[model samples]
Each structure stands twice: as structure tokens, then as C-alpha cells.
Target: MYLEYSSTKKREALKLERGLARVQGPPFHHCYTVSPASQPPMWALRRASVSLTLRSRGFNVGASCVKLAPTCCVEEESGINESREITYGGFLLPKTCFHSGYNSSLNFTVGKRALSSSSTKKEDDLEDGFSELETPASDGNESDNLLTSDAELSDDDGKENVAKEKEKTRRGRVESKLFNEIVNGPGNSVHSALEKWLEEGNELTREEVSLAMLSLRKRKMFGRALQLSEWLESKKEFEFIERDYASRLDLIAKARGLHKAEVYIETIPESCSREVMYRTLLANCVSQNNVKKAEEVFSKMKEFDLPVTVYTCNQLLLLYKRNDKKKIADVLLLMENENIKPSSLTYSILIDTKGQSKDIDGMDQIVDRMKAEGIEPDIKTQAVLARHYISAGLQDKAETLLKEMEGENFKQNRWLCRILLPLYANLGKEDEVGRIWKVCETNPRYEECLSAIEAWGKLNKLDEAEEVFEMMIKKWKLSSKTCSVLLKVYANHKMLMKGKDLIKRMGNSGCRIGPLTWDAIVKLYVQAGEVEKADSVLQKAAQQTQLKPIFSTYLTILEQYAKRGDIHNTEKIFYRMKQAEYPSKPKMYQVLMNAYINAKVPAYGIRDRLRADSVFPNRTLANQLVQVDGFRSNPVSDLLD
Candidate 1:
């Protein structure tokens, strides 16, 4: 027993019939729709005994019992087109009911409409049974119109529709197949899966390959990203552009080292080796705080006669801001001589540098200069200003600037909410933090939620922070960043057991515990007075991830050891940091010297060590050295005995 219906309507009807079959307690037989080429010959006969009870909207449509040793094929005479067939409770409608045109005398609609009627209770029950299926709500007239339209569609239109659907499915499958294979493949290397994809005769477009590379980079799978980049370049299917070369160069630097990246840059054609390529290398250098190498890259850019832009100058300013503030004036002079105007980032760097140096007057002068040049501060600039103001102990100024940043419509400028939450919390303005959080609560973004958690934590509202974290995990997958925020809160309040439980959850959930999570975990154990445990976690992290644990991870343990006057462990950790190739900074030396001072037993080779590391002592450090040298005459080591 078969019922004829269009493909779209057939899907809905099949779902409804399955539900009815389950309720009627019968073994449901599988049904297949006959295509045009497979239709039975006209006038053929078959022996069958079939019984069908048709029901719609809980109303009985009567029953039909038929036994035929010779059943005539009346499909052609009934005027039925090549529509598909579905079996419903072994029921077959009369031959005349299969007419292409609607039969008003039958008083029953076919397809989804057959299950839907004017009775709201029946409709509700049907919906409840098949809630996953989505069918449009329509009255009897609309359903009739829909069926008529389906029947009236020309054969050419049907073929075109199917072809369009097939093409869409093919395109989506092709675009995501390579990416999925690479991500879910067994090993770290994507080379094998990528090669397999090509061998499988799947077409690769430049857009598809480029998108895969971009996504890999975002995931920080630099090794896989570099492999994909190298594979694509080796195939030579697409001509290399400047940006493409630059992307590969950046990948090489990240996966390998900057020196290897430099070697690769030399292999690039001069046509592709333009300023953008050099700037890419320069940016990577600056990010690593490799001042000497970065300057060399800058010189190479000049030697190539590439026109220097404000972007390159800003990078130099940023580098100088972090290491060697004296070089900042030199970069500014170069920018002035080259007639390159300062960008917003350039001004912001200068402002931050001034603020860090505690030169409030200098920061105001930069802002004045920015205004004079007809450039208004952007949101980032305003946030930087507000932060410095708060740090300078000027709450009124920070509040005024924050209000201006909020502007006329706080809701419209939703981004400002994340920025303001922390600043308000830092100023101890609980009400302002609550107000900002309320606006975000309506439709919070991921980053805004993280900021709210951190802000609530800073305000010592553990319950509120836990509530937000709980709500967030239910909506989104638990990311390490989110977990790190709550962990930091627990660490600050010295909740060791809570931090340990979160770590266990992170492992069980397979969250990617990267450097940030490592930093937070280290801080957690350190704050809990388990310095030995903190040191062990750092060692384990170095072995686990390809990426190095961030500098702060080591520094946290070192600082704790320094406070305890554990000179041996302090020197050991400091040497480990140097072995990690972290650039020497004055703060590291100051902390090491503090360990000696706390132990009251320093008198040997401190000056030589500082000079060997190329770190100059500040006035305070100079005074400390003199005090430590005073220990030489007294010989505190002998005093300890």
C-alpha cells in the first residue's frame, strides 16, 4: 500500500506515519519511492492481501481491506504523475484519489496537512510527538495551494531544483572536508591527511586552502599551519603573492626560529620580497623583544629601499617601549625625518610609555599633541588613559573619562562594557560594575562574560563570579580562558581545593591548557603557599606543550623563592629562565638581588653577573649593591655559623 507525495511533503508525512505506526502496535514495513525508470509495467498484476486503517487529527478515515490475485495497474488511467510514494499503516487510497488535480469529494488533504487540522488539541499532540521536525503552519487553503503548486511545477523546474540542491551539497562537503580531516587526523602533522585529500581527487581552490591556513593559525597549531603552507607552495598550483610569502615566513618563524625564517626569506623572489615581507619578519622579532635582530631587519628594509610606513615606525616604538625606552626618541626622529606622521597606535605607545615612567605631565602633552593634529582618541586610547588615571590615584579623572567613553548609548556601544567593568572594579566602584554587567547580561558576548567574571572576582563577589562561570559553561564549551579566570579568583582568595577541582575538570573535559592556564595554575599554587608544587607544575608544563610557558609562570615561582631568601633555588630558576632564551630584563636581576638581601649573605660577583647580562643597574639597584657589599666586611656567611 503506497501513497504518492512530493519530496518535501513526503518527508513530513513519513515522520507522522512513523509516530502513528508506533501507537498502533504494528510492525512497520519499510517503504521505497519508485523512480520514473523503475515504474511497474502497465496492466501488470500482483497477489496481495492488505489492510489499512487511515486516521487524521485523531478522526477515523475508515478502513479498507483488499485481497487480489490480479490487481490491475491503474496508475496511468488515474492520471497520477511520477510523484514519490510513502507507505502509511499499510493503507492505499483508491485509484481515483491519486489524480494529479485535487479531489474535493474526498474531504481529506494529503502530506503534512493530513496530520494538521483546525483542531488545536490534535495539532499540539502531533507537534509534541515530532518536535524535532519543522513544518510550516498553514490552513487548509494554503495546504491545497502548496500541493497544487508542487504538482504543477514543470519537469524542467524539478530537474533544475534537484541539480541546484546536489551542487550546494557538493560544494559544502568539499569546502569543509579537508579542514575536518586535518583537524581530526590522528597525528600532529596535517601533511598526511592533506596529501590523502589531494590523492582522493578532491579539488582545492586558493580560497579554501587559504581559509584552512588562517584557521590553523588562529588555533595556534603553528606546526600544522606551516606544514600546510609548505605543502601548498611545493605543489606550485597557485602563483605566490607577497602576502602569501609573508604568511609562510611568519609561520616558519613561529614553528622554527627567526633565523630559519630569515633563511627562507632569502629564497623568496625579489619581486615577492617586498616591504611587507620584511615588515612581517620585523613584527615577529619585535614580539619576541629581539631588539638587535629587529633593528637588523629594519636596516634590511631600508637597504632594500622599501618606503617606511607608520606601521613599521609604530612597531619600533612598541619595541622601544618594552625594552630600551631611550631608543624611542630615535624612532620618533626617524619618523620625523621621513615625514611619516604618527598613527593612533604611535601616540598610544608614547602615552603608555610616559605613564609607565610616572610622567603624568608628559602623557597630557602627548594627548594635546594628538588633538592638535586633528586626531581624536579611539576607544583603546581612551581605555589606556582611564587605566593610567586609575593607577595615578585620580579616580575622578578616570570616572570622567570612562563616562565619556560610554557615550550617549551604552547599550549601542557594547564593547565599552567589558572595558569599563574592570576599570570600575579597580576604582572600587561596585555600583558602576553592576550597572555595566546588567547591560551585558541582556545579551553578553564571550569576552564580555570573561571580563564580568574577572571584575566580580576583583570585587570579592565569589558567588556572583561562580554564577556567571556556571551559566557560561552551560551555553558554551569550557575554554581554558574562562577556566583561568575563575581559577585566578580562587587563587586570589586562597581556595586551593577549588583550584585543584577546576584543574581536574579541565583535564577531564580535554580543554587545551595553554600558557595562560599554566600561569593561572602556578599563581594558584603559589598563593596557596605550595611553592614546591607550583615549581613542579611549571616543570611539567614545559614538558607538556610545544609552546613555552609564559615568562610570568617562571617569575611567579622565582618571586616566591626570592621572598623566602632561598638563594640557591632563586639562582636555579633564574638560570632556567635564561636557558629558555627569555631576554634579560632589569626586573629579573632586581628580584635575584633581593633574594641575597633577604638571606643577608651576598658579597660576591653580583656586579660582574649584572654586567655579563648587559643589564644596567638603576639608582635604587646601585644603592642595594652597596648595601650588599657591606656584608663582605661582616661576612654574614660566618655569622650564620
Candidate 2:
């Protein structure tokens, strides 16, 4: 039979159903009655073979019944002549309480009564129910004491969990808000945004600020990173550590120049002036190829009596390796005198220098020395060796080294997978490239995907390259670096239309079009026989970004102009390069001379222009200069006549 419930009593009906379900055994009749003197409200639970009915105040309460074990009942009196017990799910209830308000305190009281009751089995049942609900049960006076302790423990645990959750949420919000503000902030200045964040009462932690700085540096936002560093320093909220000072110095050198960065170093308090700060400056100098400034910084480190670390010496070695190979011997001699053991990087640099000069035997000797010193080569060093081996056409040696790097289990050597892809491709082992790429298929990392695309492109497998590129874009928000890789692949194949489509996709995806993307576009247009369009793209990139296009980018366009004998456009590009403040190299002048030669016109005072730019011509360029000068004395037009 169905029982009707009015809207007002629907909540009570639900409570009745839950209360009945708590009874654990064969159904038994139980009644709750108020004092006769009061407006008595009576409720009863009655069992029939298949149905149990509940009646409250003589009206059938809507509920379902299940058999449940009997539990002790408790009651409280309010100005009544008599009292009755009210039990709810093996717990106590006050006369005014509803079933939904069952509390742990009530369970403790019921447990105490059950413990003292004569029936041992009933007491065990009550204890079992208490254990299920994670409620404390005890005998007599001890129950109250145990209840107090349990409440305190539960409160402490709840507070700890809440605190941890709040901390996690706070850190997440801070990272999200601060990153969004600095990265997507208007214009180049993020200073105002940072200040606004502070004014809004957002706390900035050292870890969060450092992470933001690192991200900015990666994005090549040197100016904005410097601003953030300056703001952090000015706030004086945190004590500046040595690494903090070093990071600021590096940013200064990047955003400003080495000279300005040196000025900043002078302002750093003597207490914070450490070896790392100077090493940072020295490294930046080496990166910029400023040999004179690099040496001066190295001398200053000695003047400060800073321990000459292998890192600093390696920086000098690297600079000398790129600039003057002859000076490398001098640096090696200094390392020997100082008793400074060379690091793996030191040996790698030396090896690469020897490889560049095609000194295979010397490179082998260096490797032997590294092993003799008991310092094993790392993956990077082995990769370097493999690269040189391929360049030297020692394919057998390169293959053996690559096999060692892969080890017995290729799947576990994820770190070596990306490096191996291109090496195998260089070896013309398409099968090995495919094998390495298969290991990355299940969970491809960004670098691995990039390497795979490059490897496929190198092997002239355009379809395979495109497939990897497509898969990478779907899985990741394409960074400009990733897009540039595919663009380069398309550029190499002279697929202008595909490159153009990718550029549109990059724009739609909000990828930052940086120097790398510009380089790829320039190559794409040049390879497709539209040099003018390439030049236009370069110009637009420079204007939009207010940054210099890479030296190779300008050279690419200038070389195209040279090939066409378009001297006017070639001269224009050369002048633009000068405006961009690229160092004058012999190759640029040689390209300029080739333009004149291809035009079959004598460029008068070309040597004077080279001398004015302080660019020294090599022997071959000197001979070209003489040939161009002879043309002026004996005109080509005269010979034709």
C-alpha cells in the first residue's frame, strides 16, 4: 500500500525511510511516545510478514522497512510528567530531534548503555555498528573521556586537510594570474602589470617569481624579464641570494649590453659579489663573441681572488675555440698550470674544434685522454663524437657509438632517442630512424617529435615528416619552435604553398612569430624563386618585432640578390645589415664582390669601403678585389667593342 505525503511532511518521510533502514535484524515493534499531559506525538515501527508500516501521530508515515537489530533508545524530558526513549540507528535522540541530526555524541551515549546492558551479544552488535560509522564506543564514564579526545583528533585532521587544499589552490592561482599578466600584458612593459598584481594584495613568492623569470627568458622576452628582476630587487621583499644577483646580471647583459651589465655588477654590494656573478658576465661575453671583454672579465675574477672554477675556464675555452683556434693551446696550458681538471664540456669543446679542422687523429687522442682520466663521456659528449664521425665519413664508428648509446633496452633510453634519430638519418639508416621513432610513438616528447620531423626531412620522407608534424600540433599547442621545424622542412622541399598554409595556421593558433619563423619564411620564398617576397617578409619582421633578423637570414636574401646580379638590391640588404649592427665578416664582403663580378661591372672603391668598415679580406677575397680593380682599368665595354 502506498502512503501519501504532503509537501510539508516530505522531508520527515525521507527521514523515516532512512531511520527504518538502520534496523539490522528481524522486524520488531518499537514505539516513541511523548508525555500524556503534552500534545502527545506518537510514532511506531510495526512488522508484518512482508511489510513494515510506520505511523506517526496516528497517520501512516511514508517509508520502506527493512529488518534491523534492536538498539537502545534514549529520551529527554521538557516539563513533562513522564519520559520515553527515542532511538535512531543505535544512537540516542532528544525529544525535539529529527532522525537526520544523528551525532557522534549520541552514539557514544548509546554505546555506554549497551556496554552495561546484561546482553553481551547486543553489546557486541552495538560496538560493531559504532566501528562501521567510525564512532568511539566505550563503557560507562570512560565513554565521555574518549569522545572528547576523538573530537579533538578529528578536528585537527580536518583542519590540516583544509590547510593543505587551500595552499595548493593559492599556489595554482598565483602561478596562473602572474603568468597571464606578464606574458599577455600589453606592449613590452610588464612593470605596471606587476605593480597592479601587488596592489591587488596578491602575494609573490620567491619560487613563483623565479619560475616566471625563467619562462620569460625562454620566450626571449629579455626586456620584460629585466623589468621583473628590477621590480623584485626594488621591492626588497626577499633577501637577494647569489643566484638571484647572477640572474639579474645575465638579464641585464641580454636586455642592455655587456657594458651596462658590468655597471650593474659594480652596484651590487660587496657581500653579494661572488664568483657566479662574474661567471655569468663572462659567459654572456663569450655568447656575444666579445673576446676582449671576456678576457677582461676573467682577469677581474682573478683580481677578486675568486676561485677559478672549471666552468669559468670552459667559458674562456669555448670563446677561444670559436674566435681563435691558436689561443686554445694557451687556454689548455693555463688549465694545466692551474691544476684545473677539464670537465666533460671542456673535452667536448676541444673535440669539436678538432673536428671542425678535420683533425680526426687529434680528436681520437683527446677521447683517449678523457677516458684515461677516468671520466666517462656523457650522452652529449657521445652525441658530439657521433656527429663528428659522420662528418668525417667514419660511418662504421658512428654506428657503433650509436648502438652503445641505445644500450640493450632502447625503450628505456628515452633520453638518447631524440639524439639518435638525426644521427641515424645522417648515416642514411632509414630503418634505424623508423625504429627509434617507434619507441617515441606511445608518449612523444616535444624534443623527440621535433627530432623525428627533422630526421624524416633529412631522409627526404616528406609524408612521414608531415604526419609527425600533424600529430604534434594536435597534441600540443604549437610553439613557434615546433612550427619553425615543419616550416623549414617545407622550405627545404620548396613547397611554398604548404609553408604558407602552415603560416596561416600558426597565426590562427596565436603562435609568436619570432626570428626562427622569419628565417624559415625567408628560406621558403627564396627557394621558391621569389627573392623579393622574401626580402619583404624580412623587412616586415624587423619592423614588427623591432628586433634584428638573424645574420643567416640577411645573408640568405643577400646571396639570392647576388646570384641574380641585382647589385642595387644586394647593396640595400648589405646596408640594412650594417644598420642592424651585425659585425662585418669576410663572407659578407665576398658575397658583395660576387655581386659585382656577376654583374660584370667594376665596383670602384670597393676595397676602400671594406677598409672603412674595418673588415679584413682573406687571401681569396683579396684576389677577387684585385680582379674587380683591374676591370675598372680595362673596361668590359671596351673589350666588347
Candidate 3:
């Protein structure tokens, strides 16, 4: 509500004017003046004074209050313009509704005294026309006269009309109850009904429907919401509501996530401050993994108002760390300019980002910056820097940092051990690795050290790797993960024989064979041309894994036999392949043909090659024919010709 200035009035006068309006009704209700509940009392009083003057001239003043639902469209005089409405309760006074009601001719043109005089005549005839009326109020009370005259003018079915009004109010309340249950209650059936309502675009208000839609979106029932939105779009009612509805149609864009909903964000009103918009956009961006957009929104947010919350700044810093170091520097500069105090996350982000770039000097600069700002780098920041040093092969620096952390009562975190152990092993710093392990002895980071032990074996530092594994198994009494790690390392380095021996050692130690263990053994046997041994390994692997042999597992043996030109062996493996029912490629038939030809079985070989060419006609197998031990009329050549 807008108010005209009164230079002479004191605060006391304003309070008195408000008191008069509450009892007597607003004077300017006919002119569409409004007094919103949130309006300062002082402003309300001034509006009341103007309103009092209009009412004194016989304008009818009816108090109207609107309680909006969460999502609604603001009413527009012209059908084309639409504004989004936020639902709020308590007091809502709009200027236009007042104008329509108070500016009625009988309200403005006829004086109260004329209406009161006519009410006396109507009361006299009440017995004839309105027998339901018992008695009218005594004549001396002008308030009662006003009430009676108003009732009489509407023709004396006052009791019945009041009852009807009460019924309507009851029905409105009931509808609101049903709507609340469907949208907010725990029942799935109610939720489904609301979804159906949204789909139909029926007589329900947009605010209630949109509220339910957003709730469904939050719950990740996007498919249902999209189906409803699409149905709503086909309706005549929702078509002109807002084109941005399509933008808000992210409910169905399962793959796009929040990235798709972002288009609708800009449609929010310009009247909203940059701070509000940025917060909303930032949240949406981070939720959808759009780190770049999160950065852009954060940058925009700072241009308007530097975020002061620990959460917002931390999130922005995290994004910077994950992406660009330059952005971290930019954020630091912005932080100082905005007079925003840097938190631990700010320092951690700068350090981690710099470390990722391997800019040791940059990381040193961050430390110096933190000291200058009187902010201590926390354990996380130190861990990041320590890890960077280890990656750069600065063992002395990393070790010194870890020792310093210990002296300061900061136990070296498990994550740092995970990183440093592998790094030391790769650099072959066995002594440094042992020292870290001893430090971990008193801590809970022993398992993390296991990963590093495996990394040593992978780098072919087998003696050191075996030493670490023995220590973990004998001293730590840990699980078979240590053995598993060793197994992987051997297999990765193509030391399949070593892996098989390790599997046998594991079995001897009462560690029954894991399938991975058997797979390693089978690979070794097959590579060593021990087909019978490989088949035995496969059987053992199946018994250990409990699950049926995967196709690749059987294919592995068949492929080896076919490649070796061992036709007898390939024929024996074919029984297993048929039982497995694994899909065979043209390559398999070609390999079979090669094996047949190698066995001096040309008839079988040529027949298989022809079948291969028919099924697959490209590359090696797909060629017209192989001119092997030149026969004048090659079967494959004949088929191609």
C-alpha cells in the first residue's frame, strides 16, 4: 500500500486513527486502497484516515482478506499478463477488491440515514414478508440499524442465507483438508490422487497443484510428475498459464536432473534481489553436478553480496578445488574485498587446488597467506599439502610434515597414509614406507597400508612387497585382502605362475580358494599349455565362486584351444562351450577352421571357413579365401566366385 505524507502528524495521532478504522471500517475502501498485514502500523493508520473520509460519504466498506496457497498466479485484470504468487497467510489486503465492493452505487450514493429510515418500514412489514424474523434490534443503536437495514434490503431470508453461507464455509474448509491430506500426508494413495488431479488440470488452483508437483520432484518421482505436466500442457487451462511451465518440466528429464530446471530460475521476478536469486541458482547447480554453473552463480552472488554463511562459501571453495586454481585465487581476492573472513575450508580449498596443479610454490603461497591472515591450516589442509609433496617425490618434506603433525597432537589421518604408502613404495623408499607403517601401528590406518603394500608388488618390488604382506598377515592378523592384493599385483605384472603358487599357499594357510584365485591359476595353466591342468583349475574356480561360470570364463579356454591349432583339444572344449550356450562370434569359427587345417583336416577346415564367411564378411575371416597349400579349385574361392 502506498501512503500520502502528512508532515504535521505525530506517532500518537497515527495510532488513534488506526483504532477508529478497525471499529468503523476503512473510509477509502471504495477507491481500492489496501492495507496489507505486513504494512507498518504507522502506514496503516494514514491509509485509514483517507479511508475514513470516503466511508463518511456513504461508501460501503467490506473487509477482504486473501490467504494464498504456496504456488499461485496473481490475479490479472487482463487475461494475458501473469505473475507468480507466493502463498502466505495472516493478512492480505488488496486495493482492487475494495474498490469493486465499496464503489457500488447504493453504497456510495445513498446515505446511512436513508437506509436506516427504509429499514424501519421493512421491519414493520417483516411479519408479512419475513415471518421467520423474530425481533429487530431497538431503534437507538445506529450499528444495529445498519445491520438490520442491510439484511432487510436483501429480502429477509437472513437466517436461511446465513445458514447457506456457513455451509459454503464448511465445504471450503473440507476441500482444504482433503487437499492437505493428498499433498502432505504419508499415504501413497493420497499422493496418487493428487498426481491425477495435476494431470487433469481440473478446477484446482495452480498454487496447490504446483506445491504438490515440487514435493513430488523432491521425492524423485520425476516420471510421474512429467506425465502429469505433459497432460496439463494439453489442457486449455494450463496452456496460457506460463510458457515457463515447459522449462519447469524437469520432472521427466531424469538424465538432465537439476540442470534442466535451471532455465525456469531466470523467470523468477527481477524484483527479487541478486542474493536470493544466486542462492537459489547455486543450490540448483550443485545438486545437478553442474560445478561450472555453481561457480558462475557464486561469482554473480559475490558481485551483489559476498556470501557470509559458512556453508555457501565452503561449497564455492569445494567447487574451485575440484576445477580451477585460478578461481581459488579469484575467490580469495573477492573474499578480502568483501571483508568476508576466511574459514578453514577456504584455506583447504586453495591448498588442495594448488596441489592438484603440482604448484608447490602456489601451495606455499597459500600457507603464507593463511599465516598472514592469522588463520591456522587445519589437519585436512596439511594432509593435502603432504600428499602433494609425496607425489612430487619430496619424501623428506612429506615425512617432516607428518612428524610435525604428530608433534602438534594431530594424528596422521588414514587418508594421508593411503596416499603416502603407495607413493613411497613406487619411489622404492622402503625405509620411509616402514616408518609410516610403524606410525600406523598405533593408529587405525593399518588397512590403508595394505593398499600401498599391493602397489609395491605392482611396481615389481617383489621382495619389499612380500615383506609387507608377511608383516600384515603374521603381525597384523588382518583379513585375506592382503593376499588378494598380492594376487592382483602378480596377475597385473604377468607373473601368473607366482600368482598360482600364492593361491596354493593361501589354500595351505586354511584360506580356501576364492574364484579370483582360481581364475589366476587357470590363466597360468592355459598359458603354460597345460589344458588338463587348466580344466581342473576351472572346476575348482567354479566350486569356489558358487555362482555359475560366466561366459567369458568358458570363452577364455575355448579361445586358447582354438588359437593353438589343437583340434583334439578344441573338440574336447566344444562340449563345455555347447553346455554354456555362450554366444559364439565368427572369430571362434575361424579359429576352429585354423585348428582343423593345422590338423591336416582340410575338408572340415574349408567347410568351417565357408560358414565363417557367410556369417561374417569383413576383415580377416570375411576375406574370399585363404590360398593354403594351393589346391586348383579352392572351396572358399569357389564359393566367393
Candidate 4:
């Protein structure tokens, strides 16, 4: 029993030392030196005999020091002597677990200090700092080899992880052609691919289908995701769980609307109930803002004994906020009655509603309640508070809130973004504008994207403006207003061909060219002194839109041509304006008359037009005519001093 106790204690000590060694890397040493024999000698010993042998070897069993008896045999056969190893012959005081290595000197060192350059060193073993030199060349084609396919974007911190995930998924190619089709091809093609595989006697696991379905949804290819789900439901080989049906219903809600989603709910098997389907249905109601339907669904859920969550209540509250704010109280009361816990989002939205209604005191109380409930204010909440302060003209309060938010390095979400982006832009906060621009680009509304693109132009970030413009065009179809804003960007950058191509694309897509688009083109060309191009855009805009140009647009064209002393084109524009029934502005003809006068041309042409019109341009033209060689009809043109 004594020997067994000692042996157990030794093993425990060895384990503890090894643990310590792992924790204290590099400087520690292992406790025992391994010596290989035909078999492990320690196995043959009696329990007490092993203890006797351990103590007899001068090991001092409990002591930290482990000494080795000499086991070296000196052989004198060759000219050069080599170390011969028989067995263990070294002291070990271990903290680092190391495998055995033969050392003839048997020098044991423990817990050595880490090496640094300040330590004394010999010339033969010299170490020096790196010399000043140019950086090494990089492979230019390396960037070309980077993953360019649009993988589903993750958050900023998860970028590397997502990249590595994509890399691994890309490398772990499955031999199954069906799996390849699902991955390589997007959407509904996955259904066809799976069918092809199954028809050939192939099988699929639940995990594979679930992952593929999830991947499709993540990529926002909902149409294809629904197709796969429908195909699977039709197959006798596979059965979808409750969650699968719920997910399919959600995709329907998104791709279709609440009506179709309701139809989808009817088709669900009796196995699915309010508890399983509530989230997807409530999310649809949230999107559709169908208060009546939402209320109906909530009542049905209560009838079916489904537990209400804060998210469901939040949606009902959102619908409530749209019409009767008093209905918000019912939601809160329902949440309390149901014992549903509110998340930070719940409190934040409540605070925002209170702030917006000008119930500052109520807002503050909710904030206090939030703190009491241990719900911290997030970016959206802070943004709402700051905007309220701004609206109340409390600049200092807004500044304080912004500073606190900045100190936390808080990333803005859709809520804070929509509120604060225009505010930052209007206030000329360029850096904040840029940071907000990145957040806005994730899923920007047309108005916000147009605002961001114009803001980038204001900051002279031409490339960034172009990038945002392209992204907006690719993601959402542009309206006349958006395209006009983009045209102005191209004008500012002097990329005329790009502007021309953009306008052409707008036409090809059956977008009507509004007066604003024409004005934008005319203004761009007029500012650049391209009178001919400006006139071309105006005529096409007038003809294609079948609507008269705004009086201001006509005035701009007249003014630009008059400034160039091109009386002929200016007069032609004045006649077109008259024909278009644009109420006459006297500035139009006076500009042309002055042009004819300064160009040393007779006022004969101007006088003839004035004579034709009695009221319009009569006084304005007469005033300019008195400046040049007194108005005379049928007179030859001549230079005048």
C-alpha cells in the first residue's frame, strides 16, 4: 500500500509538472529522460520493489531534483571517439514536456531567461538588426487570384472568417455532380440538379439539403430557395421538419406578399401550428404593415396557446405606431400579461417612439426603466436621443451623445443610419459621412443612396461616388431623380461619354426622360460651353417626353447661347419657347438682341421679330437696340466703335 501510494503520488507529480510546463512555454524542462528497451522495465517490478528501486537510485523520491546514475561505456576502437548511449544518465527538473534527446555533456539547464540582443555575445555568433533596404517586390497577379465571386458578405470582424470559410468550401469539392450543381449554380437550378442526382439513384442527407437551402437564402436568392423546398416537399424520399416548412413560408412572405404567405400557411401540414408559424407570419405583417391581419393572427395565436415573444409584440407595436399610438399601450400590456421579456431593441424602439412624440419626460422615464432592466442603449437608441436633441436645438446635448457613441466605436445599423446619415452630411462631418456611407451601402434605399452619391461628389471623392452610383444602379432600378443625380456626378467629373451612355441606358430601359433629366444634361453641357450638345439634349427631351420644357430650362439654353454671341441659335430657341406656349420672360429676347448688337449684326432681324410680336420683347428689345447703331431695317452689317 505504501509503494502504491508513492507510485500514485509520482504520477500525479509528473502530470502537474507537465501541465505547468505547457503553461510556462520554452524555458521549462521535462521531468524524465526516455530510454528505449525491448520492453518497459518498470512494468515488471513489484509495487514496493519499484519504490525501493526509485529511492535506491538517489532519486530522493519526493524531491524536485532527479539525478541519473552513469550508464555510459567508453569504447576505444575508432580514430574519432563518438558518444555511446546505454541508458538514462542525466538530472531533470522538468516543467516543459520534451521528448528524449542524447547529450554527451549531460548539462541540465532550467528556466533560462529569454534571449535578447543586450546579452553579451561572441563575434563568431553575431546577430545584428536588419539594414535599411527597399521593400521586397510583390506579385502583381496575386490580387487577380483573390476570390472575386460575390460571396455573402458578413460583418467587418467576421470578414476573415467568412473568407476562410469560402476558401474551405471552395477547396472541399464534392464528387457528387448534384452537390456541385447546387453550389455552383444559383437558385432553382438546384432543384433540377437534385432531381437529376436522385433519378440516377443518388441519396442526400438532411444536413446537406438544409445547408444548401440556407446558403441560397443567405445569398438572397429566395425564388430558388422556394423552388428547392417545394421540390423536396413533393418527393416521397424526404420529409421536411416543422422548421423547414416555416422557413419556406418565410421565403414566400418575402418573395411574394402577405396574401400569398397566408395561402402558404393553409398548405402547411396539421403538424405546424401557431407556435411554429408565428415568427414568419408576424415578420410578414411587419413588412406589409397590415394591422388588421396582425391583430387577427395574434388573436389566433392566443386561441392556439402559442407563447408570445417580445419580437412578436414589437411588430404589433410597430403596426400600432402607424395608426393609433394608444394601441401601443395594449401591446405593452399584452407583453406584461404574457410574461414576455423585452430585449434592448424593444426598449430602444419604445424610447424612439416616445422621443418622436415630443414626450421628452416619457422618453427619459423609459430610458431609466431600460437601465433598471439592465438593457443598455445601443446605436439606434443613442441616434434617436441625439436627433431629438438636435430637433429641440440642443446642440451641446447632441454633441455629448455623439461623443459618447463615438467613444464606444458603435457601428450604426439601419435605424441610426437613416436618421444620422443626412444629419452628418448636412453638418459637413466628412469622416462621419464616409463611415456612414459604408453602413448605408449594405442595403441602401434609393433616396439614401442618391444622397450618399451626391455627398461623395460634394467631398470630391469621385471614385467613391462612381462606386456608389454603380452599386445603386446594379441593386435598384434608377428613377429620373436618381439618374439625374448620377448625371450631375458624371458632369462634375467631366466624363461626358459616361453621362451620355447613362442617359442612353435610361432611354433603352423605357424610362421617360423628365424635364429634370433634360435640365441636368443641358446644365452640364452649358456649363462646359457645349451649346450644340445642350441644344441636342433639349430637343430630344422635348420630343421624347411629349412635354414642354420648364421655362427655366428654356431660359438656361437662351442665356448660354446669348453669352456665346450666337444670335441665330438664341433666336431659334426663343421661337421654340414661344411655340411651346412657355409664358414669355423678357430676359430671353433681350439676351438675343444684345448678342446680335455686340456681334456687329444689324438689329434688322431682331426688329423684324419684335414687330411681329407687339407686347412681348417689345420694350426689352427696344432698350438694347438704342445701344447699337440706331435700329435700321434692310441695313448692311458693319463693325462699330
What pairs collide in candidate 4? 21-95, 29-94
How accurate locally is residue 95 in candidate 3, as Cα lDDT from 0 to 100? 17
Candidate scoring better on TM-score of 3 and 4:
4
In model 2, pairs of residues that clash are 23-68, 24-68, 24-69, 25-68, 25-69
Q: Relative to the unseen true structure, what is the C-alpha lDDT of residue 530 in candidate 4, on a scale of 0 to 100?
A: 82
What is the descending TM-score order? Answer: 1, 2, 4, 3
Q: What is the total number of backbone clashes in candidate 1? A: 0
Clashing residue pairs for model 1: none
Please estimate how well model 1 matches the true structure, expressed as its whole-model Cα lDDT. Answer: 0.59
Cα lDDT of all candidates, in order?
A: 0.59, 0.59, 0.43, 0.50
| Model 1 TM-score, all chains together | 0.68
Error of 4 at 211 (Å): 3.4
Q: Can you tell me which runs of candidate 1 are displaced by over 4 Å? A: 1-181, 196-202, 302-308, 630-641
Model 4, runs deviating above 4 Å: 1-190, 196-205, 337-339, 358-361, 387-393, 408-423, 431-464, 467-641
Better of 2 and 4 by lDDT: 2
How high is each candidate's TM-score? 0.68, 0.66, 0.32, 0.43
Candidate 3, clashing residue pairs? 27-51, 27-52, 28-51, 71-207
lDDT for model 4, please: 0.50
lDDT of 2 by residue, 1-641 (tens): 11122444445534553464354222122232322122111111111101110110122322233343222210111101110111111111111121212111111112111211111111111110000011122221112111111111110101112222334356342334465567556766678888778888998987778767655553456777888888877878788876677778888887798989999989887786556577677767766656557766665665566655455555655665444333344344334334455555566666565555555654664565556555566555677788889988999999999999787977865756777898899999999999889898887865688889989999999999989998876776566767788888999999999999999998897776767788889999999999999999999889986655667789899989998888999999999988986656556787887898899888898878877765545444676788778444446678887
Cα lDDT tens digits for candidate 4, 1-641:
00012345445534543443333211011143332121111111111122222232223433243332211100000001101100111101112122222211111112221011111111111111111010111122111111111111111111112333343456453333333456554443656777776777866777677676655554445666777777887774476767777888888876676679888888888975556576567656644445446555655555455555555655555554433333344345334334455555556555555555544544555565556555566544566677666666767777677767556434532434434554565445689888876776666654467668777776777787778777766665445656777788777677788788988887787665666677678877876768788999888768874444655667778877777778788889988988885433334556766677667675655555544442233333445766553544333444441
Error of 2 at 419 (Å): 1.1
